[model samples]
Target: MVDASGRQARGEPQGELAGRLRALQELSGLGVRALARDTGLSSSSLSRYLNGQTVPPWPAVVALCRVVRRDPRPLRPLWERASNPLPAPPKSSRQGRPLPRNDLPRDVPDFTGRAEQLAAVFAAVESHRVVSVDGMAGVGKTCLAVHAAHRLAADFPDGQLYVDLHGFTEGRPPLDADSALRALLAALDVPSERVPQDGLEQLAACWRAELARRRVVVVLDNAADAEQVRPLLPGAGPSVALVTSRNRLLGLDEVPPVSLDVLSPEESAELLVRASGDPGGPEGRLARDPESAAEVLRRCGHLPLALRLAGARLRHRPGWTVGVLVERLAAGASEFDTAFAMSVRQLGRPQARLFRLLGLLPGASFDEYVVAALADLPVRDVRAMLEELLDAHLVQQPTADRYRLHDLVHQHARRASAEQDPAAERERALGRVLDYYVHAAAAADAAMPFLSPGAPPTAGRPPAELPPFADKNAAFAWLTAEYGNLMAAFETAAAVGADTHVYELPRFLRAYFARRCGTTHLNVLFERSLAAAERLGDPVRLAEAHSDLGFARYNAGRLAEAAAGYEAAGLRVAQAGDARVAAELALRRGYLSWDAGGVEEPLDLFRLAGKLYEEAGCPAGAAHAAAAEAWATLQLGHREEAARRPGRCWTSRTPTPPGRPR
Candidate 1:
């Protein structure tokens, strides 16, 4: 390809790179002709180099690498390619070629259990070219990330790299995000650690420069948070990143949430059967009983670690049946916790304490509540707790105000509680919640008497010193404000065997009915209240609840059901011989029959109910009944007949046309 001028006279070197070499000679103080003279090359050949016609050979390259003091190894490939570009390979088998021997660790173990999660991670690898797999510890977040990165080998030609951030591990001081960034920069084949000491910006620019178009995948395992991941991002979308953490990394506002729940019953069993290798013999019939499998899964809380442990136990003791394992698990109340303990035992003491304290809180799905409750100190006091746990992926803060532990984490939390606190401390932690609810309820109940107009506030200090809601209106206000929360507390107390709350809580909430909070809300939860009252055998509470339920049902328009419920209440009331309540329920039942109107004797029933209400001195009931009769009479196309009940018909409040008291 040489020309008569001893250069590429006929079509040789293409563009920019050729120009750069010529600039290199001028800048390095090697005047083109003098450069040729020093290397014993022709002027014309040197001119061609300067004019960007032909790239010079190795003698020139050695000269260049020496002047720059950089490892010329990087530019060598570019130089050789320009000298003679390799023919583009044919399209027949183009995929997953390894990086040129320097991109990753010697071996990355295959990660199992979280297949769907791994698949999603891989899909992110495939689609985003940049992905972060974030979740809590023993949720197998990292394992899934590793597998996803490996699966995406085809996506990235530049290869995969891994780093353990040690964010959650005890005593293993976490590298500042910048230090981690430096390590990543070095991994990308950047020669100098002269990476920026301050901003990760320069290093990230270098990373993009290094990985640009190379298509690498970086598994930023155990990341601290977004500030950590953001600086490390190559920005070259061709590169994929999967981050693993206990923190929700809500810090990365852009990434969609890929929440990892404890495995489902079926998923857990598949893990067990696959990991333990068959519940033994003939299509593993032992594994096929879904109930037993579900029980086995439940014992493990369907978490991966416990499932893996159960599977491992079975694998070692091949003769054990699924039922035997389930029993062992059922007996080990800390079984899931035991499984996570194995993972945590690998951690240092400080981390273990943090992990344990995280378990001793009042509720599942916690937040700052967890920080204060478990650590038994302010979130401010436990300086790096969130970061530490986040790195380990032990605590998952998937959203604002929402933090979840993997079921495995809950298991670990139980274990953590036993180790971190004495039984008394654990009880104390639980007692705070109990006492808070009890006192709060006492306050609300003390306020309840005020809800009914003109009902002088119940005094005498409640015999329990329950706080006053200032006055009666305050009681109703408190009840109204805390209705849902109070109900939730009541349910919790009831579940924990505090039957006093089970009986008394509903009475306090009876005023809740006025809000018309909707039948759906009642239908969902109040049936449990009725069942609790019945189980406790409280006739008074039961009668009141049934009456309230009947009224609720009637108001909500399940008329026949309401009538049945009121009749049930009435039977109980009549037996107790509470004449006023008995009379009211009786009127309500008769009115239900009249309004329903399938019977021909509706007028008779209404008149009788009206008389009963009047005898009981409930003008509201009498007025309601009178209104019903007039409405029914009008419905029968007898408006003239409807004018008959004047004395009973809010007569003190209305005048009649015919003046008939009939």
Candidate 2:
């Protein structure tokens, strides 16, 4: 095919052929070899092209023109006139409808809140070459990633390529790195047969080589882990990659992770409002009570799937009110169970069982030991099972050795547990898990001695196995790993109506999980325990739980609620004939009322508390109460009497000297 000058003879249309070839040969004064040296195309390809034996592909033609010192525009018209056309691609097949998030269509409603997370994710996209959004399952990681990507797509010229690694899709194996690379290669137009097999390194090289000098954006969704993502990274040139994974993917140190937490109340409401699909209508009226709206989000956990489903349910029947929806959500276990259950049912039976078993464990997140206890299997088997369940998205593997499920998913798992085993069988199974954690936590607590209302247990039942407490360091590590799930178990047990668990788990955990660990969510969950106590209607435990919840509420800024709760606890104590605890609650109620703006009813509580304190034979408590009454006297403009009281040994530590600034 080489012509006399060693250039590949050029190919052209039979009729216009001679003229185009004559023009090209004339343009290339140095002929084939010279053009080959300049363009990186082989002399044979050039000669074949010039001698008219073959037509050149676009890139080849562009190279030829560049080497020959000619503008491509002259050949452009003729090239454009050529009859070549690519084969049509196969029609896209539908598998199932993915969650309809507000990440696209420019019109879908985005939930409110996460203003900081939205900004953080956007900053990552704009600032980094590759960013990953990683988090626990149903934490809205994908929503945050996709929303950010679509917002930044303008900067990526070659186009955005979004592929779900399907790493966690039910019943699917993770698409290996090589196959994912091939998919990327195809999107970039490398000839299918030319794609090298088994040479993933080579394929990756080719993919980057092709993508060099262009701006491209690639999103790898639901990756199993870093190994599955390594080859797909575009290392050769300018590009951005956004990877979402259940695994933390710490293996990729440079892939900055946006490990998402659950949505806050505001964000949940915004999502509910959008899902409710109202335009200046009843949805607005419903959203007016963010507390109830937050309750819905709480039941749904503000996960994209759960929130979207909640919206879908509301939208499906416009006649329903928010309160009605709340009534349905108050169904406790069955609220979002149907939808999350189907998501689990789509998984293999083993993975589904693993997911259900995860529900039997405590916490929003947990260590592998809980898995071992629930499955009654070796840690290794539980590890593998957890891995598979995570990849199927039936469970979320946030970090190595830690996993979680959505609230809705967790409820369904509990239902599955209740159904799959005999009552004793299930109780014993769950009891082992509870014991495993409590035992482990107790050991960690003994070793660490975190800040709490109590002292080192000079006592209680001996633990099953002592953690490496002899090594001061290992205890910290174990506690760090197990802390979240330990707290989660307390809330989980209460939610599951686990009678002993409702009260005992908190007592066991409060010693280990504390403010030093930044465990503030405990305050919110204790309120739920109060609700649980109310539901159980046990007078002694109810009063104790109410007092616990009341203190937590006082610390959490719900002062009025705290005051009311303490008052309610006093009533419960009174009914139970526990006058001593009643007096303690009276002191707390006085303090709460005094702090929450009063010189009136709070004055009443403080005065009453003083009488009770005196009657209870605690003079120091009475003196403290007298000090608070003195302050209430000052606030109500009884300053002469206030001057007379002289801060008589304040009965409560709660500061009560000030009144609302008038």
Candidate 3:
């Protein structure tokens, strides 16, 4: 007999009879029309009987068995069983209708973050008929949606329906919209026979009709896109559809989307504490060492999935500290790689390639042009691919034209790149980016005057098609934007033994670093340059490198190191027969003495530097030395002695500005 949805629901007798009929048909090797002729029955009627859609009379069953050369007596009992009606549900349980299926997952008990997001979802559910929640994989989109749905369940008395669309699932394709519609319809208590199975539109119509007068809550979780979610949504009614996806689903109409970011550090720590099982036990220890706790959160990328896993790990290991977990994560241990892989696996080949290359990029963020250069693709293509990544939440664009991978995503990309891309290919890609920055920074540096005029020039062919800088301001702005990246590039080059790049980049960066007052990075950059220069064993280059390092160290208030750097530069300059640079170093050392509050020694050193500068026919240098000697005399509280001893230099020069030697 046919069930309510028009599909066959056969009892044991019907199953046996249908099995005998099908065997007879196959043994006879006849079509339905031929079988009908043999049985003197209409083709449609015989087909229904054989297919178990309907039961036939005893005479018809016998006729079918006889046609297949079998006795009908053995099938009588089977037919009797098939004719009996199926049993009904218990009277108490089947009073009126089935209870509303509350298939929503249990809310996360330690759901520590997203107070604002929860509030927003609550507010949106009140005003909007549909709410879309989207974010990176493992950022708690599903958890947040479930929590919100549970809170809003009372508002919708009809029922709550939940479905996992399997979007971005590792090995399976996303659930199709038609299948999803059938599922939603089934959840709404539509009988199997009545639920439309032909077209998505028809199924959608049935779904809407069911929810039209009711107040149901639908949670379509892990959706593939707007297309998959659109038909599943109930038509305008008291019902609410809460859709969650890794994709942004921007194409959905009038559905206000909420994008979830990683939890704040405070929230992350709180989550860790709560998820630890013993909130006051291990959490109390974490509270005491806030810095280490923060490190643990950072290692987890402040993402809920990672944090939960870390917390679980900590809970299992009672003897382990938060710092222990942080160390493990720092040493390349990760639990969220698979979660990230699901999203990356959804990208097209080009987009995937761009993402891997992004892992090799130097800094936290980059623009399209840098991405293009790194991937060796056209900028237009890179932009389009980046948009795809952005939509997938694999990358984030915090500001216009600048994109960055989340820290955990970056780690995944790096691991993927190392595993999938050849070492040589990665090296080449990194080289291209480093070369670009070196030439680009040099171009920017050219538009700005040197901070220290005596520093040596960098020797390299200008890279072609570099972005133009209209003036010093534009150049400085570009440099400022790329400052961190440039520093990273320098560090990368040094690590790879690219000595020429290592030594040359700082020479170009000195002006910008000084202008920006970036003493900390300057010190590190120049120290790296000195090491690279020493590896090359070029005395003049070493002299200039030491000079740059000395200035950087002096600015950082490392006077002893600064003095040693200048002394090392003086020795190099003397070996290279650069009397002018030697004189400059002597004057710098004299200024250092003055800075150390020594008057007589600086006075003597400045006098010697002045005579040497005069011998080199550098009048400005001699005048600077004289001015500094007079300043030293004034520092000794002998103002008259300072004025008379260096009258000409004092009359011609103003007091040296701060951070500038006279």
Candidate 4:
């Protein structure tokens, strides 16, 4: 291939250019973070460039070459070619696509009431191709949206997609617009390399473009507001979207919405009986005691979730009359309290304890292993306990092995745990959860080490066992799935003054963030970690924290703040007398200096780093520093002197380094 500069390139422009740029990075012997620090590029962006997932701008290519003293002019032809590759072929209009995706959660079998509301949703969809269902918590917003999507399935034959935005989920933050857009695009089979890494507007445009060529239905559940759901709507297409939120989404003026309320008294009575499986005969409990049945409906507040829990309790007890159920629920004030308290009261002590502890869980949903950790029980025993909770309708089994509590139920459980469990017991349970995540994250980080050449020592006590990660892929999958929960754990630990955990947890997520999430969240985490480290007053940890914060700032292009961090870290490292940390610090300091436009000072820093690494018995680190010095020498046009350094450096590590693990 040839560019307008009339220079010939070989192989695919993007892939080949990425390979050559990667070679330059290897020649300097710097990890991805180190390279990004010196190049004034975000680590996430640089990672994407090096992995051939994205094409860097011309200036970025020049920056990389300048660091290693490679001639940028020679690579310009290839960079130009890569920058303007032919666009992808247009997708056909769903004529021969794969089988339709059915990601909607299983529709409730005993779906009672909401007849008018369902019809309203259908009417809105017919007019706008988008309709939102808004209601209070536990009022069946999600149920209505999913039911409508399933019923309208034949109209949009391409696929059915579902995304739980986690707007009001306990412990987890609302899913941001960018992450939500990425999920929606991925559900439509968009390739990762094709998806934009930054810019919510760009991702949304791509999502709309993709949807325009197909007929599909998407259920966007638990949206925080209109801004979160607006970008996900289809543009001028037969495809439709159904959004569910607790509050009215006034911002989505183009999309009609159905405002839902609690079931009518008659509808509520019918639902309670149907869900309880009481026969129509006079011999049944509902028929035998009309007054008590009405009381049960009142106690449930005519809400669907509360009614289901109440019905499940009655269905499981054959001997109990309607009056007995009412008496058990008579003490609570709110519908959630009445229904959730009665259901939780029926569990054995062990199961009840597990249910209460689950309230402390920080993720949107969890599997049995996390349950085991939170309850400090054996995994096998935890499975049976979770089954019992699911049977009581206290916990929702969204998927086969993943479960979550309804929002109202979660609030009730949290309240009950605070009332019943002691402070120390609650603290210990949450500590176990922190330990579980830190240990598992560290293990997963180990299996798929990123540009982490000088990783710190792992912290936190490990649990009795951890889920096995068969390979890097499996490890990453686990990390991605648990990311929200892990963040929640970090926040919980920090809030409770678990300083050690607060400082240690973010260390494992750096590589993950560099690949999937952007630097914004990573920067927040390291900032908090820095605070926790200072509180602990451990010089080594404090120094590491400063260095980590500096690295994050450097990636964010905050050079002045990054310099301040590095200076503080140097003082702490000197006090701690840790040669390994001192060497890493020196190496990073050198990169920062180089990026700040100093040619000679950075070389001196590199030499000092190599000497310190040698003294610390870290041959790899010493080699890395030596290579950095050689590259700086070459950048200064001292080719002969630079040639000798690599002969020694090459023996310590592989010459052709692999791409980022992610």
Report the poorest 10 consecutive residues by lDDT, candidate 3.
Answer: 650-659
Q: How do the residues 1-662 of candidate 2 rate in per-residue lDDT, one tens digit apiece?
A: 34423322333342243356557667777666876787776888767666655555445665555565565545543543342323445555244432321112121346456678778766776666778888876676666666667866777766677666756743224666765675576556555545654356877787777667667777787889888887787775777788889888989987777778777666666777776675635537465665676667777876666776666656756677766666666654543574455445546776676676666664446666667777666776767777766544456654555666644466677778778857887666666765666566666655653212222222223333333566536775676456545655554465556655555455445533332221245465566667666777878767877776776666555676776777778778877765445555666676565444333676677677667766767665566666767766654445576667744432232223422110
Off by over 4 Å in 2: 1-5, 8-108, 278-291, 332-662
In terms of TM-score, how similar is model 2 to the real structure? 0.38
Alpha carbon lDDT of residue 302, candidate 4?
Answer: 92
Q: So what's the TM-score on candidate 4? A: 0.79
C-alpha lDDT (0 to 100) for residue 372 of candidate 2: 70
lDDT of candidates 1 onward, in order: 0.56, 0.61, 0.74, 0.81
Q: What is the TM-score of each candidate against the true structure?
A: 0.37, 0.38, 0.43, 0.79
Q: In candidate 4, what are the lDDT values of residues 1-662, reduced to their tens digit?
A: 34322322346788888888888999989999999999998999898888777777656787898899876766855775676565556667435666777888888888878889999999999999899999999899998999888899988888899988988876667888877787677567776666775577888888888889989999999999888888888998889999999999999988898999999998888888888998867888998999999988888889988888888888999889999999988977777898888988899999999999999887677888778888888999999999998888888887786898877788788888999999999988888898899888888887775433545435566777778888888888888778768877887887878888899888887777766665566778899999999999999989989988988887666778889998999999989998878887888888778666577788899898889988988776777777778765654545667777752433222222122111
Candidate structures ordered by TM-score, highest first:
4, 3, 2, 1
Q: After superposition, how far is residue 194 of candidate 2 from its true place, in Å?
A: 3.7
The best candidate by lDDT is 4
lDDT of 1 by residue, 557-638 (tens): 6787787787778667756654445545554555455434333465665566567667767665566656666655644435
Evaluate residue 449 in candidate 2 and report its C-alpha lDDT on the 0 to 100 scale: 39
Best by TM-score: 4
- Runs of candidate 4 with Cα error greater than 4 angstroms are 1-102, 154-159, 170-173, 182-214, 236-238, 451-460, 557-564, 587-662
- What would the TM-score be for candidate 1 when compared with the true structure? 0.37
